[model samples]
Target: MTVIAFLGAIGPLVFIHELGHYFAGRLFGIKSDVFSIGFGREITGWTDRRGTRWKIAWLPLGGYVKFAGDMNAVGEPDAAWLALPAADRARTFQAKPLWQRAIVVAAGPVVNLALAVLILAGFAYGYGVDRTPAIVDSVIAGGPGAAAGLRQGDRILSIDGRSIDSFSELARFAQIRPAEQVAVTINRGGHRFVRPLTIGVERQRDRFGNEYRIGRIGIASGSPVLAPVGLLEAPIAGVRMTGGIIRGTFDTLGQVISGRRSIEELGGPIRIAKISGEQLSLGWAAFVWLVAMLSINLGFINLLPVPMLDGGHLFFYAIEAVRRRPLEPRVQEWAFRGGLAAVLALMLVVTFNDLGAVGLWQRLAGLIG
Candidate 1:
């Protein structure tokens, strides 16, 4: 079940992402030599009339589109391929204008983001927004809400001047603003007033042993209510949801980099596979929602200015635009090597964390003991 769910979830994402780059390259007359859905040995493949080898590889961690004249999947320029005849060179990726190449490089992540937005929009259209009012049922003593004069039966009106329609909205708003002071408005006894409070920090551990630090305001909600979304409003809701996810991701990463959050919170392929299976057990809707979130994360990660990624190519193109020529091949090679090392180190760390989350280390120790 785990393997099946993981493949089902990641297969479409990888294919769609590579297709984005493929189509964008085709638009500018650049030919792709390979369109692979994985990194390693080919499990099965076929060559198309256009001469592109479409394949499913053994390693399912990621995929790539290798354009003609590129040294590898990262799109590094190949000197030998560059020396091809004029007609052959014309259809190669390196032969295109710098702007065109940049677009082709960026198309993958952009398409991933677009996919997330479309999925979220479809969900909003089918189901509605959460309409549970932000009514406080209880407030824990000595907590942030209690300290701020909040009490039972108080209805939250807004936070930081933004209207809060549901308890979920209020909770989400507070969760992202951990330990930060915010003005929250509430109505009690038919009178409304604004109260400033510093949201408390809470460290929580999930059943999978993954830890997270989130904001806690010391209040609980009654129950959830669903409200139907209008056709016209669904797209807007989707865009807003995607934007929120992007912002939250940035905030979490910033905290991780700053040492405010534990690095154990970062998970790699193993954790994703486990969660994918769990969500699949819950039902298709939950699984698809998880997929949308992962899509957003995929797009954001690829856009970072790290070498060997789409953003890296764009970064190089930006420099070429300024200097009117590409960087020296030797320098680019060294930079790519460093980028590969950094990426590999991160992967190892995340994998270690995932193993720990699953209690692999403990099991090993028990056997040795």
Candidate 2:
């Protein structure tokens, strides 16, 4: 069931990402030689009328679209193919303008982002969001809220100058910044005032014995309400939600890079499979929500400025646009090799983390002892 769930969730995303590149190439009249659903040995395939060999390969990790006049899936120009007649060259990816090539390389990640936004928008339009005012009914004695002079009937207006509409939003903001001081804006008798509030922290452990630190302000909710969003507002809400996720991801990565967070928090395919199966057991809603979040992550990761990635291709294109020529072939090749090494190292680290998460390393150590 776990295997099936993982495949079901990941397969379509890979296909869609490759399809984006294929369509973009077609749009510019560039012909594709192969459209593969995976890398390596072909399990099965068929040639279309346009002579593109569509195939499913043995590995299900990732896929690619191989365009004409290219050396391989990486889209480097093949010397022999480049030497073909002008008529043939005109229909190849390498024959296109730098701007066109940039668009083709960028289309994959953009489609993933669009897919995430549409999924979130559909959920908003179909079910709507829960809404409640950030009104304080009571404050816990000796807690952060009481220490900050928060009292009953005071309405929380914002946190750190960012306006919040509901108690849920306020909680979310505070939860991420445990032990940090933030400016709390409150509305009392229609007049607003800001106060410096140090959020109280609590240590929590999950069923898996994973510990987490969360913030508390010690305020109780007054009332709760469900708000139905209009059709026109749903897409806007989706975009806003996507933007927030992106920003949060950046923040987390920044912390990890700065040594303020542990890199063990990262996971790979094994972790994704476990989570996908868990979400499937919960219900389709939870599963699809996971998909939407993963889609956003997929899009964001692909846009990072690293070689052997779509973003790397775009980076080269940007340099080409500036210099009026592409980099030397040998230099580009070495950069791609370095990029591949970096990507593989990251995969190894994440896989090790995933194994540790599942207690595999501990079990192995027990046997060794």
Candidate 3:
């Protein structure tokens, strides 16, 4: 059941991502040769009236759409496409105007992001957010909040001049700004005052032994309040949530790059599968949320300015726009090769981290001993 649930979660995302490219190509009058939901040997397939071969392949990890006039999934132009008649060449992806090609390439990531927003909006409208007011129920003795003269029943109005809508917001703000002194505004008995509190920092480890630092103010909040979202406001809330996730992802990546965060925090397919199975066990709502988060991750990752990614293609297009011509094929080929190598290296590292997190190596060593 777990395996099934994992597939159920990943398959649709891959399909939708490829579908975005396919639809965008068709919209620009470009022909598609294949729309595959996986790599390697085909498990099942059917050809459509548009001469597009839609197929399910053996590997279920990722998918691609092969456009006409392309040699492969990487969007390399084919020599045979150049040899084609003018009428047919006009229908090829590479033969399209630069703007059209750019749109077709960018459509995949855009659709993934849009899908996340739509899913989140639907969830918000159906089941309102579980929120807690930014009111302190208790402050730990001798902790940062207590030391700063905070007391029970104090309503937190803002932190560092940023207005706090809920306790979760306050906690998130603190978590990311560990060991920093922040100006917090609280309303006590109809009077508001600012308090300078240096947030305490704590290093926490998860079940996997992955450690990260978080800020602590030693404040507790009351029970959650169900804040109902109206249909009209749901989409706006969804966009806001998606933007927050994207910002958080970049911040974490920046931290990892800057040595503030451990590289072991990175995870690959194994971690995704484990998370999906756990979310499935939790309930439908949790699984849906996982899907939404994964969609955002996918979209953001593809937009990274690395070769062999949509962002890479966009980067090249920008150069073409400025220079008024595409880069030489050889240059593009070498760049893509380097990008592929980098991607493979990153994947291996993340996979190793995932295995370590699950204690696979430790279990293997135990068995051998």
Candidate 4:
């Protein structure tokens, strides 16, 4: 089930991302080499009448669109188009205006944002988000909140003085908060009790690096109340949710860089898979939330300024815009190599952590002992 959901969620999402680049390239009159759905060797594919080789690669993890002149950028041959005259080179990606190139580069991540909005709007239209009260569930034993004396049936009023009139508000605060002391207000029975919580670092890992965080009480959100507004309002709410998530992601990154956090707190595909598995076991409502949350993550990560990513390409475009031409091919080549190395290192690290998250590490430790 997890496998199914993960593939269903990622495949269409990636197709949309690559389609953005492909369509934008066409709009700018840039020739595309291929429109691929996955990486590595082709599985099933057909070349378009325009000579673009559309194929699904063996690796199902990610996809990309190759542009003409991409081969030349790396000093490779145009063997596939050897029949074309040298005069036709203007159709290559390099021949496009700097602004057009920038637009093409920027479209990939923009499509991701659009997909997230659409998905969220779908959920909002069919099953609108309820303004659920921030009701407390059970606390994990020995966890930070338990250590702070939080109990069941407590209705949280605020966190660090941020008013939490709804579960969404509470979560809005929680999403960005790392390991830090926080003040809380909860209505216990009929009386409101204020308490302070000092969160200890909880570490996680991803395909990039370790990350750390902190949170107060464990929570099982009460159902959202019908906050019914209007039919046209769902899209607005979806876009707002995407923006809020992006802001929170940036805030978390800032916290991590400031040494208030650690890298071991990151969670990658393995963690997500587990969560997806568990969520499926529960019900569709949980699954929908997971999709929305993961959509936000996808949108944010693609926009990160790492080389080989959409944002990185956009960054290069910005440079070209100022300089009036692309950077030296050699410079772009070296940058891409370094970016690939970084991505690989992060992937290996996260994979190891993923195995450990499934108790592979601890079981090995016990065996050695």
Top lDDT prediction, candidate number: 1
Model 4 TM: 0.76
Model 4 alpha-carbon drift over 4 Å, by segment: 72-87, 129-167, 175-179, 182-214, 217-225
Comparison by lDDT, 1 against 3, better one: 1
lDDT of 4 by residue, 1-369 (tens): 778766666677778888988999999887888888888888999988888989998877778888887763222224455455665676777666777877887787788788778777777777776678788766778876787778888888887776777777676666457467898888999998889887555456653343434454455565558676466998997887677667777777787678665555466777777777767666777776777777667767777777777777777878877887778867887888887798888888777878876788889999999
Tens-digit lDDT string for candidate 3 (1-369)? 567777988899989988899999989899999999988999999999999999999988899999989888877777788899999999998899999999998899999999999999998788887578999998999999998999998999998888888998888878876777889999999999999999999899855455678989999998888789999999988898788779778877887898866798799988898878878877899899999999999889988989888989999999999999999988998999999999999999999998986789989999999
What is the Cα-based TM-score of model 3? 0.88
What are the lDDT scores of the predictions, listed in order?
0.90, 0.86, 0.89, 0.74
- Whole-model lDDT, candidate 3? 0.89
Candidate scoring better on lDDT of 3 and 4:
3
Per-residue error at 20 for model 2, in Å?
1.0
Q: Report the poorest 10 consecutive residues by lDDT, candidate 3.
A: 205-214
- Give the Cα error of residue 67 in candidate 3, in Å: 0.4
Query: Mind giving the per-residue lDDT tens digits that candidate 1 earns over 188-256?
Result: 999999999999999888755556778999998887787788888988888888987897799789978
Candidate 4: Cα lDDT at 237: 78
Give, for candidate 2, the lowest lDDT window spanning 10 residues.
205-214
Query: What is candidate 2's lDDT per residue for 247-291, written digit by digit as tens?
Result: 778867886788755799888999899888878877899899888
